[model samples]
Target: MTGSLETFLSTAEVHDAVFSLRPDYRAMLVVADGFDAGPSDAASEDALQAGEAAARAALRDRPVTEVPHVAAWREAYRAFGAKPQRTRNSLEAMMRRAEAGLPRINRLTDLYNAVSVLHQVPVGGEDLDRYRGAPRLVRATGEEPFDTVADGAAVVEHPEVGEVVWCDEAGVTCRRWNWRQATRTQLSEATTSALFILDALGPMSDEALDAATDDLTDRLTRLGPDVSVSSRLLAQ
Candidate 1:
């Protein structure tokens, strides 16, 4: 468990944190291996565009907030003192933009966004290279540093105490559950390996999550190289 999150999932460090998740809390951790997050080719870009189009068509008449999966994430946000409307979850924000035509980033980024829209789940990824240690999810102390870029200038901020966050030895990596990711672990063209976290709540069954993980893994492996994937499901 040298570099795996499972090392601390059941350890004393996370015992109290996992206990805090209410009865309905659920999540799936998907870790990919032998990835090549380099520049996308024509086919990859085309698939990305197609996925966005499908999402827009599916959510055309309804807003993201009305979607069951997206709404569940909103509840998770409120559970930690966040205003979901003001601070939209990453999936909700991406759905909005997809409706208007999603922005194209590198292959890895596009891959998750496409899968997210295809399954209507909150899919977040991090560059394993920048991560300081195994993953940890706990209540922030409001003193841990989180690095990000503001107006193109580097900045470091701290999460409010008790706000649920994903962090490591370095500092906070994601604040307020799936709301945001730190700049330090952002996936880039050079990223070769990564971890993706899929968030879910009640009504999202284990079978559905396993299917989604398979779907994403299949697509990512097709991108290039002998990509491998390992996953875990955390539910209450």
Candidate 2:
């Protein structure tokens, strides 16, 4: 874990081609090690409740796409040949689901998802132990492997050419930008060290992203006294 964390510290980045497509793109990577990973408890539930309330208030009598950050992500998806209406970004999807209820997967995942909605940003939480190397945001060439489950059976899929993806040495960890995550690296109760990716566009200012990141960091830090957290913001 120490070696991988160090690799992530020096190697995570957004490729130039991705920046060429959306120069205003930004990604904040937050890594936490030695967390007390466990099931969602009172704190996480409270955060989720607050996030759901915030989403409802923000979307009052308006469509989810009208949100500034969500609108920006919509354009980004289209820029990469994906129809945002069909394949919604993580933020928009979470906003849409807020009205019903957000799933409580684990403390780590729940906390990040809550912060994501609370700040109106797209957030991805991954199990650090599952990664083979540093993570990078880039435009896929249709050759990277993306592991997922289909019909309750494990399977592999490939991204469309020019599609935006987050990958490591193993393969694509997230496909279509933030629309979906590879099952292999998803956070679970067994996860102790974790990596969180907060995706942002021009519509979402750096201050707002940092606020969200800070909220998440604070929450993670409270999980245990020995939790160690670090973060870096990548922009071009």
Candidate 3:
């Protein structure tokens, strides 16, 4: 847990007070350099499809809710007045979309989206360059700004009070845990620096989380030449 990402998390005062991830909570942080988030290639597209197949297989006999670990995400969402059915966590959302097939975005995004569905974890990435000051997971006061694209226009919105969010001095970087990402820190084809977060809760073991991170690391490290990777487990 070092670099701009670590600095971002440590500089926030309200992080631990609001988001004391339970003793069984676990998050795998992957910070990388030399990332080329260029357009998706043939191989990347294939991998995404394969991951979608796996997701479909996982849901063939059971719904996402019965997945067990997803129950923790549902509880967390309800704590903030969000209905998990209406505002699905990243993993559930990806699983739904993956049932048919996943849309190929880019090499970086495609890889993570695939992994999220495959492992059923909430995985998200941020363009580290767009972050301002430090980032923290805190309960929103309902006044801090959040920049996002609404419809086809850029809009500034405020998060609901008690909503858990990832924020910095500028604005909210991610809202409702892993539900949405801000445009400010969006990864693009030209992005070279990136930070990825993997969330897991009770009923999910550390060994499973480690396996997911290892897979993610292996694929990302080969994203481009000279890519350097570092990872840490952020948990209780």
lDDT of 3 by residue, 1-236 (tens): 23644554445443564555344656677878776779999768878988888887888899878877677888878877889999888988888888678878888898888888778789998887787765577888999899999899999999999888888789898998889999999888888888788888887788889988998898888887888877777664
Candidate 1 or 2, higher TM-score?
A: 2
What's the distance in Å from true for residue 125, model 1? 0.8
lDDT (tens digit, per residue) of candidate 1 on 65-92: 8888788788878887889989888878
Question: What's the lDDT for all of these models?
Answer: 0.77, 0.92, 0.80
Task: Please identify which of the two predictions, 2 or 3, would achieve the higher TM-score against the true structure.
Answer: 2
Q: Number of the top candidate by lDDT? A: 2
Which candidate do you rate higher for lDDT, 1 or 3? Answer: 3
In model 1, which residue pairs have backbone atoms overlapping below 3 Å? none
- Score candidate 2 by lDDT: 0.92
Q: Candidate 2's residue-wise lDDT over 16-92, tens digit each?
A: 99999999998899999988989999999999999999999999988999999999999999999999989999999
TM-score for each prediction? 0.89, 0.98, 0.91
